[model samples]
Target: MSTFGTLYRVTTYGESHCASVGAIIDGCPPGLELSAADIQTQLSRRRPGQSNLTTPRDEKDLVQLQSGVEQGVTLGTPIGLLVRNEDQRPKDYTETDLYPRPSHADYTYLEKYGVKASSGGGRSSARETIGRVAAGAIAETYLKRAYGIEIVAFVSSVGKIHLPSSIAPPSAVPVNGADDNDDVEDSLSPEFRKLLATISRAEVDKYTTRCPHPETSERMTKRIIRAKDAQDSIGGTVTCVIRNVPAGLGEPVFDKFEAKLGHAMLSIPATKAFEIGSGFRGTEVPGSKHNDAFVRKADGRLGTATNWSGGVQGGITNGEDIYFRVGFKSPATISQAQETAQYDGTPGSLAARGRHDPCVVPRAVPIVEAMAALVVMDELLIQNARKTAAALLPAITTLPPTMVLPKGKQ
Candidate 1:
C-alpha cells in the first residue's frame, strides 16, 4: 500500500520519530538534471518551525541524494533520497504508549497489527509526508521539463476566514482574451494563463498563510493565532490548479485521471474530502450550465469555453487547466483535555501530546501540490507508453534502429 503510481512509482519509509525518513523513486526518466537542492526546496517548505501557525519543532530536513544519479544526471535507476530526523522528541509522546489518544491511529494501528510504534502516531504522522514531497519534487521537475505542466496550490480558507471571490484567481475562460475583462467567460483566457505562469513558491511564502492574496492572507494568519491561543484546532480547504496539461493523459475504465488523484490525495494525513473542477457547487447548476463548451483553440486543438469540468472530461485530460479542492478536518489532537477510557476500559482523561500544528491546512499546501505532481507524472508516463504503442503499426514494425528485417526481406 505504501507504493504509489504505475510507471513513476515511489515507496516511502520511516516514521515521524524515526532516525531518518526517505523515499525510493523507481521510475524517473534518465538524464534529467537533478540534485539535492531541487529536493530540498520542497522539504524546506514542508518542514516545521517556519511559522507560528504550524508546529514549532525545527527539523533541518537536509536531504541526501543517496544514489541513482552521477555528476548531476539521472542514471534511470532507482533514485534513493534520505533526510535525517533532527530534534525528534519521542519523549513528548511517552504518555500515549499506554493510553491511545482519541481520534488518532493509536488505537486502530494496535488493533490491526497487535503492536504499535507508540510515538508520533508512528507512520500516521504528517512528518512522513516529507518523503512524498521529496519524491514529488522529482516528478514535478520531469513534468515541467517534458510537458510544460505547472501546479499551484494555496490556502483558500482558514476556519471561517476565506479569500473573497472578487480577488480569487480567474476561473472561467476569457472570451475576448483580454486582461481587464469585466465580464466572465466559460473558459480560461490567454491572459490568465500568463498570470498563472508567473506565480512561484517564493511569492506564496511572502504571506505566512500562503494565500497569494495579501489582504486575505493577513486575516487567515490572525485567525490561526486565535485558535492557537484557545488551545484548539480548525479545519479548512485548499484549492489547486494544474495548468498546461496536454490532452489524452488520463486512463479509462478503472484507472481514470481523477480517481488516481483522489486516491493520492486521501492517502495524505488528515484529508477528509476531495473535489474536482466545479465540484459540489456545480451540483446546483443545471447540466446546461455545468457542461463545458467545446471551442477550437488558436493552437488548433479543441478547447473548453468553460472549465466547469475542472480540466477533465469522461476521466481524461482535455488540454485545459485542471483545478480541484481538498478538504481537511481539524487535527484530532488538541491541548484541551477530553474524558475518555483507557484501552483496558479504565476511566481516564487525556490531553493530546507531541508538537502539533494548530491548523494543518497551512502546512498541507505543499503536500497537496506534491501528491498532484505524483499523479500527473504517473499518468503522463502511461500516456506516453500508449502513444508509442499506437504508433507501432505493421508497416512501421520493421523500421531501422529497432527491428531489422533479414537481408533478402529488406
Candidate 2:
C-alpha cells in the first residue's frame, strides 16, 4: 500500500518523528544521471522552517542515496533513498495518548491498524512526502532528458485568496439558461494559459507562497501569517502543468491519465479535492461550447485549438499541455484548544503542540509536481512498452482509413 505505479514503481517508508523517511524507486531506466543533490532541490522546498508561515521544525531534510547507482548514473534497479528525522520531539505529542487530534488521521489510523504512532501525525505527517518528492525528482529528471517534459506547480489559492487565473468562472453561463448569443469562456484566460506554458519553478520559488503572481503572492503571505498568528491553519489549492508530453501516454477505462493523476495527488497528506482541466467549471458550459475543436499544427500533427479537456481525450493524452489542480485541507494539528473526544469517547479539550504549517499549500507544490511526474513517467513507460511490442507485428496495410491510425498521427 505504500507503493505506487506499475512499471515505474515507488515504495515510500518511515513516519514523522521516526529515524528517517524516504523511498525506493524501482524501474527507472538505466544510464540516467542521478544523485542526492538532484533529489534535494525539491526536498528543500518541502522542508519546514522555510519562513514564518511554515512550522519551525528546523529539519535539514538532507537526502542520502543508498543504492541503485554507480558513479553518477542509475543502473535500472530499485533506487534507495533516506532522510534522517533530525528534529523529532516525541514528548511534545504525549497529549495524544489520551486524545486524538480532530480532523486528523489519528482515530482512523488506530481504527484500521489497532495502533498508531506515539508522536506527531506519524505516517500522516507531511514529512512522509519527502520520499515521494525525491522519487518524483528522479522521474522528472528522466522525463526531462528523454522527452523534454516539464512539470511545474505553484500555489493557486490560500484560504479565501485565489490567484486571478484560479478565480471562479463568472464568465460561464448556465447550460440550460444560455442562448447561442450567450458569452462563455469555459477555459482559462489566454494570459493564464501563457503563464502556465512559460512559468518556471525558479519564478515560483521566488515567493514564499510559491505563487508566481506577485500581488497575489503577497496577499497569500499575509493570509498565512494571520493564521499562524491565530494559532490556527488555512487551506488552499495548487495548480500543476505538464508540458511537451507526447500523445498516447494514458490508459483508458480504469487507469485513465487524469484518474491516475487524481490517485497520486489525493494520496498526499491533507489533500481534500482534485480536479483536472475545466473541472467543476465545465458543468456550466454546454457541450457545444465545451468541446475542443481539433486543429492541425504547423508541424502537421493534430492539436486541439482549445484544451478544455486538459490535454486528454477519452481518458488518454491528446498531445496538448496537461494541467490540473489539487486542494489541501487546513492542517488538522493546530496549537489552539478544541472541544473534542478522548480515546474513550469522553468529551475533553485538546490544544495540540508541535511544529505544523499554518498553510500547507506552499510546501505542497513540490509534492504535487513529484506525483505528477510519477504518473506521467509511469504511463510513458507503459505506452513505450506497448509500442515496442506492437512494432514487432506485421503492419496491417489493408485496414480501412478510419480503423487504422494515419501515418505520423502524433
Candidate 3:
C-alpha cells in the first residue's frame, strides 16, 4: 500500500518521470503552522544536480500546496503537496526498453505491469522519495514541539571506509577515559555553542544535506570525489540516533516501534539492510554481557547502567538514545560495461551512460533521519490520542443519569 501509518497517514502518488509527484498527509493535527516553503526546503535537499557527488539531472523541485491549510496553519484536513517534474530526459532511457538497467527495478516493474515508463526508473526512482521527505519534515516539526525529541543521522561508513570508533557507536562509547557519563553536554563555549547550533539548523534547513562536524563532512566529500574518479560506485551505512523519545510511544505485540522504523528505512531506494541497538554483534555475546543492566537514579528515574539495548526494551523506548543503522547498496549505474541481456532475452553488453552519485551514503543520511522523524512523530500522535481517550474514561464513568444512555438506545 502507498499509505503509511494508522492515524498520521501519508499517501504518496506519481512516478519518477511523471509530470509530478506528491503526497497527501491525512490526520495532521490542526493549527500546526505549515507552508509551501516548509516542504520546499526538504525537496531541495533530495533534488538532483546539487553537487558533483550526485546525479546531474537538475530540477527546481518547487512545491505547490494544494489544500488542507489556510494562512499557514493546518485546517484539520488532509495536506496535499506537489512537485512538478521540470526536467525529464526520456531519450536517455530509450535504450532501457531494449535492455533493463542492472540492479534496477526496470525488469521487475515490467514483469508486474507488462509495461514500464521509459524515462528514468519511473516509480522505482529515488525521485519518488521527494514526497516522503516533504511529509517527514512536517512530522519532525510536530515531534520537536510535542516531545522535545531530536533526530540526527550521518554517513557512518562508505564502502570500505568506515567511520572511526572515536566518533562514537550505536551505543555511547567512552570518551577521554571517562565512564558512566552518557550525557555529554555540549562542552563548547557560549559562542561556539551558538555557532554549532546555527550550523546544525542550517543543515536541517538544507534538508538533503548535513555537516554536523564540518571537518568530517569535508573529509567525506573528498573521499566521494576520489571514488567517482575511479569509475565505480560505493555503498555505505547511515547511523541515526533519536533522543528524548518518551516511554510508551509504541504498542506491544505487533506494532513495535522499531519494526515501524525498519519498514520506513527499507522503503527508501537502495536501502539493503536495517539494524537496531547491538544488532548482529549482540548475537555473538553471552546474555550477561549483552543485556543492559538497570540502574535507579538519585532523582528516582530509571536508567540503564549500559545502553547495549540502545534505549529500547520490549520494542518500546526506554528514555535513552535510540540508534540504528541503515545500509545502502552501491549505485548501479557505473560507467564500466558488463555483459547482460536485452529486453528480448538476447545476450548483449551495456555500459550505463548518465550522471549518478559515486556514493549515495552521504546524501542518504538526511533521508534516513527524515524517515526516523516521521515514524517517531506518528507514534507520538498515536500515544497522545490514547492518553486523551484514557483521561476521558473516568469522567464518563461518573456521568449523570440524564447524560448516560443505554448503548442500544443511544
Cα lDDT tens digits for candidate 1, 1-410: 78998999999999888899999999999999998898888888889998889988888899999999899999999999888998888889887866788888989989998988958878998878988999999999998888888888888778777766543433321134355434434333454344355666777778888888788888888888888898888888887888889887788877889988899899999999898876765544557656787998898878977777878888998888887878888888888888988889898988876788999998898999999999999998888887667556455544684575443332
Candidate achieving the largest TM-score: 2
Which candidate wins on lDDT? 2
- Any idea how many clashes model 1 has? 8
For model 2, residues 17-135, the per-residue Cα lDDT tens digits are: 99999999999999999887899999999999998889999999999999999999999988999999999899999999999899998899999999999998889888889999999
Rate residue 62 of model 3 by lDDT: 91
Model 3 clash pairs are 45-208
How are the candidates ranked when ordered by TM-score, highest leading?
2, 1, 3
lDDT agreement with native, every candidate: 0.82, 0.89, 0.74
RMSD of each: 6.5, 2.3, 7.1
